[model samples]
Target chain A: MTALLVSVIAAATPLLLAALGALLVEKVAVLNLGVEGMMLMGAIAGFAVAHSTGNLPLALLAAIAAGMALALLFAVLTLTLQANQTASGLALTIFGRGFSALVGAGYVGIAAPTLPRIAIPGLSDLPFVGPVLFGHDPLVYFALALVGAVAWFLYRTHAGLILRAIGDQHDAAHVLGYKVVRIRYAVVLFGGAMAGLAGAYMSLSYTPLWTQDMIAGRGWVALALVTFAAWRPFWVMIGAWLFGGIMYLALYMQALGVPVPTALLSALPYLGTIFVLVLISRDARRIRLHRPAMLGRPFSAGG
Target chain B: MLSLSPRGTASEFWRYAAPLLALALTALITGAIFAFMGRPPLLTVTTFLVTPLLAPGGWEALLVKAAPLVLMAVGLSIAYRANVWNIGAEGQYTLGALAAGGLALALPDAPGWAIYPALMLAGLLGGVAYASLVAWLRTSFNANEILTSLMLAYVAQYLLVYLVTGPWRDPDGFGFPQTALFSDAASGPRLVEGSNLHLGLIIAPLIALAAWLVLNRSVLGFQFRVFGQAPRAARFAGFNENRLIWLAMAISGGLAGLAGMFEVTGTQGQLTINLGPGYGFTAIIVGFLGRLNPLGVVPAGLLLALTYLGGDAAQMNLGLSSAITGIFQGILLFCLLGSDVLITHRLRWRVRA
Candidate 1:
């Protein structure tokens, strides 16, 4: 039971982080669909750094930087060039996958030092919660803290209000002199950083090795998690954990020798995402209420 | 400093020149990438992009690769025109191939004329059925086709995997996860004496031309343009958005399926485990680079096909990674998007006075 819980948390951490990044970007009315690519870049860079230097913090920072670089590219295109967000995001993903695969070609089939686990001395001695919650790595805790942090930042703070307002009506925010473009750049970068961190969590802590396209569809799942949560940070946590459980459920079924095709089982997460999307998207009015009005629309001041 | 100002009207010159400019910029930047990787920049770039065409049998391979690409891009370009995003062409292609291959496997001894057309029809229907799922969900549930279609792609891949590895595995093939080779009747006849070139080479371009005519001259094409350019206007004009979505999906999916069928009928006469190369995703680039014009897709398809060939060559000769192909493709797209802005706006040199 404890092992199952631990494994589920490991799976959920990456999705949670990536979804949080996407959530922030969505909140600002900028749909940067390159989360998959940014995650891959983060995975490769993090693995490369950790393998060479054996410095986990430095490795994490490297991952974050890799993600931010790609985000910067997206920003330049969609914000400056005013390219279509959907196409630009696809370009970013394709580039990220290619660039990471090129860089990680040598890193494949290699193991890297993982993030060190830190167990709280007093809290770890508690009853049933002790083993599952306390003795995980720093990222597991950092991801949980980020949920609260994102919620607080988005709801209680003046900046968060401006971010929401920008997503809802960028022209209005621009007239009020909130620096819509600059703030978007900041959120987009932050989203990239979190995606990178999520990717590193996979390479550094979860798997401890590098592989091409290792993140698989988890990045896409993270994107779906944003919709599943209706862009709410707290619900994103729940959705991430839920998806994590569903994804692992497939493996468990396989291990238990269930009378089902393994390939079909492998496809469960994607199918589940589609099912969940259908459920949520059925209510068009509900989506309209929470969805950023200016999402994926190019914003120009005084156009 | 440079600034961009609206031209108030689209520039006809840039409309023609944007793709060319993007191509030139891609070559320049790609050369720099080779240099950064510590290779002779010019030679590496030439070897990667140009040398493949000069190599023996290279043109034949390019034609073979371009066949499927042009077909898929034709479908996608039309759909993109109607503002329908069906990015799951890969999945549609896989199902098409599977359906056709299954038919071929079932009736391997059937006459070529009879079996081949049946196979093609199966491929077309298979694609249409799969794509309809996306259309139905989007029109009914307001679900995003981008995600749903992409998700369905994963499912299609797994379905293919299950069939090939389990039920369809060749008994005499020594533990390989593949089906037996199709009979000669099922493989279809080749066009040339000594090349992979087949009837698909002719069919792909012909289909593109047909699509070009329909898109440019047909009333349905007018509806597509109206719907994409102004959805509100299209609605007011009494155009059915749902039917358009269905039509677009069916067209793209069917073309993708046909391409997959061509692959099977050509060199890949058997279902195999390693059937993926992301032709669907790359075709999206082809659709865009071609300016979403069917006639333009022919050249666009060939250029991108060169990337696949060059990527293999670079991997073998320069020991460059295969991912370089994807990087270059992505760079080409970014260049296209950047240069495309010039079609609507011009860069002006502003001197502060």
Candidate 2:
């Protein structure tokens, strides 16, 4: 039970980080749908940096930088060029995947140095809950801590209020002298950094290897989690944990020889997302209250 | 400082010229990437863009590859025109192949002509049914079709995996994750003696022509245009949004399914997980590249199909990774999207205040 719990946390950490970042972008009212692509770039960049430098921190920084670079490209197109957000975002994903694959070709078959587990001095030795709660890699703790920080930042801080205000009514925000595009640029880049961190977690800590298309659909899953959480930070964390548990449960069930179709089990997260989306969207009031008001709309000061 | 100023009306000259500009930009960017990779840019470009058509068997292979792309893109263009984003055509394609392949397996002894049309129909229905699920969710629950359709595509892929590795695994084949070879009677009719070109080449253009007629000459097509251009006006005009969504999904899904069936019976000659390298996703580019016109998709499909052949040639001759094709495709899409700015605005210089 403890082992399973630990595994679930390890699996969920990347999602939590990615979802939190996506949540931030949502708060700013700009939808960056290239999380998956950004994540892939992060994974390969992280792996390449870690493999060559053998420094986890440096590898993570590289991953974050890579993700931010991609986000910047998206920002330029959508913000400056006034292109369609959906199309530009899709292009980012496609380009990210292709670029990562091209770069990762040389890094295939190499094992990344595993991140060390940090067991709390005294609490980690406690019975039952010790390993589950106190023993984990640093990234897992950071992801959980980030949820709390994001919730506080979004709910308590003035900057957070401004961000949400922009999401709710961009024209109004623009009227009030908020630098809508500049703030959005910063927020989008932050989301990219967080997504990159999540990708780094996948290659450096979770799986500890570089493979083409690593990070798989985790980025998409993270994007879905934002909507599933109704764009709330606390709920995003809970949703991440739930998905992580389901992901590990699939493996655990197969290990016990439970006769479930392997493919069906593998598909549970995606199917679950659609099911959850239907359930959530049915509550029109809740969606109206939580969904970013101008989620995919482009804003230009001159216009 | 530079700014983009909207013209009273977009320049007609640039409307036709932007795509050409985008293509040129894509070539330059891709050539730069090749140069960075230590490959001769000119040689690599020739190999990837020009050499394939000159090589033996190139035109036939290009036609074979292009058949499915054109079919899928034709359907996609209609859906896009209706402002119904059906990204799950890939999933629909997979399901169509499954349904058609299942029928072929069921009637292994049937005559070629008899089973072929039946398979195509089955494939079309399979795609329609799969896509209807998205339409149903979008209409009934207001679920976002973009995410739902994409999610379904992943599920469909896994379903294909399950079938190929489990129930459909060939008995005579030594544990290989594939079905038995489809009988010759179930295959697509060839266009030439001992060539890969099949009936898909003929069907693609016919469908494109039919689609063009429907989009340009029919009341329903006008409704699609209105819905895409102005949703409020469409609603005011008493067009049912939900019905339009369903119609769009049905048509696109059905065509995608037919493409899948053609690929299985006509090209691969059997069903496998490797039946596509994302013809459905690539078709999205074709639809956009063709400016969402069915007639335009023919050349768009052929252009994309060229990349595939070129990519393979580059992989074999220039020692480039197959991913070069994906990179090139990505660049093309970005260029296209960026160039669309010229459709409504133009670059200008203004004096500082």
Candidate 3:
């Protein structure tokens, strides 16, 4: 049971990180559907860098750089050029997938370096919960720390207020000299870096291997999680765990001699996402609980 | 600081020319990609751009490929025109195939004439039913159709995998992820002897013509155009947004189903795990590339179809990955989207002091 719990937490870490990044982007009113593509690029980039240089931190930095680069392209097309967000986002996913395949062609089947777990001296000695939480690698703890930092930054900081104001009303924020575009660009890049970190976690720590199309729609789930949590940092964590729990149930159910087809069970998480989305949509007032008013709308100065 | 200075009509020509220009740019970029892969760029380009249509059965393959694209794009154009982004057509297409395949499998010994029409009808109904889920969600609960349609696609895909690997598995065949080869009774009639082209090819153009008439001549078509262009005006004009949404989704869904049915009956001759080759998704590109004009969709579909044939040719000849097709499709759509900037806005040079 403890082993199962540890595995579930490991699976949920990448999702939690990605969802947090998406939450930040949503707070600034940019709907990026290319998270899957960005994550794939990060996975490949992180794996390649780590395999070549044998430096874990550098590989992570490279992954974040690669992710930021992709997000910059997205910013150019959607923010500056004013292209359709949906189409551009999908294009980015397709582009990233193809590009990663091309770059990772030679690296197929190569084993990735395992990240060492940083065990807490006191907490790691706990009987059941220790191994599941405190005995995990540095990335798991980093993800948890990020959730707290983001929650604080979003609610307790002046910059967070301005960013929130922009999301709520870009024109109003612009009139008040808040530099809407610059703030948006910064937030979008930050989101991309976090997404990249999530991807790196997949290649470096979690799976510790490389595969084609490995990120496989996890980014889409993160996108859904943002809405599932109604854009709150704490709820984003809950949403990720809930999704992770559903995934664990699928694995556990199969292990318990259930006759359900594995493919159907594998699809349980996505089905649960659809159900959650329906529940959220059913309550229109709840959707606006933490949603930025200007979400999904392109901002133009003096419009 | 730069300010908005709209370029004139002559400059707008360059905007519409952007897609063509972008295509040229993509060719140049991909040519470099080929060169990097230790292959002759010109040779790879020729294989990718021209060699596919040169083969003996190439034209037929192109037509077969274009048939479903045209059908789905035409239907999608209706929904897109109404500003209803139904990305779940792929799922609708799959469900249509499932429905038609199920019907064909149930009546194995039925006469060909009786079974074919029934299969087609079943396919159409399947698509409409699947599409109605999106429509109902959007109108009934105000759920974002984009995510709902997209998420449902995975469910539909998994359902296909389950059925083919489970109940629909061919009894006589060795362990494989496919259903029984469809009988002659279930297959669509061939349009030409010794060719894969079927009645779907003939039916596609007629559907396009009907769609064109609906959009151009019918009042409902006018409502769709107005709704898409300006929703507030549509509402102020007393247009029933709910009715329009339902009608557009149903039409798109039904046509997508027909595309799936034709694909199963005309080409594959069996329901398999790979039934949807992203045709439903690609049709979105085709719909926009054709400028959402039903008549224009034919040439666009054929053009995109050429890329599929060409990509296969390049893969076989150049020893490249089949994913090259996806790359080319991505580049094409990206270029088209980038060039479409000229349709409404133009780039201007600002003198920096």
TM-score ranking, high to low: 1, 2, 3
Tell me the tens digit of each residue's lDDT in model 2 across A80-178. 888888778888888888899889999999887877899999999999788997898888889989999999998899998999999999999999999
Per-model C-alpha RMSD: 1.2, 1.5, 2.4
TM-score of each: 0.98, 0.97, 0.94
Docking class of 3: medium
Error of 1 at A225 (Å): 1.3
| Cα lDDT tens digits for candidate 3, B1-353 | 54444344436465447667777877887889889988898889889988988898889989999999999999999898888988788999999999999998899899988999999999999999999988898888877787888888888888999999999999887979899988886886777776787889999989999999999999999999999889999999999999999899999999999999999988898999999568988888788777788987888899778878887897788778767876787777777776666665655677887
What TM-score results for chain B in every one of the models?
A: 0.98, 0.97, 0.94
The deviation in Å at residue A23 for candidate 3 is: 1.6
DockQ values of all predictions: 0.83, 0.78, 0.62
Winning candidate number (TM-score): 1
Indicate which candidate wins on DockQ.
1
Which docking class does model 2 fall in?
A: medium
Q: Candidate 2: lDDT over CA atoms?
A: 0.89
Off by over 4 Å in 2: B351-353
Q: What DockQ class does candidate 1 belong to? A: high
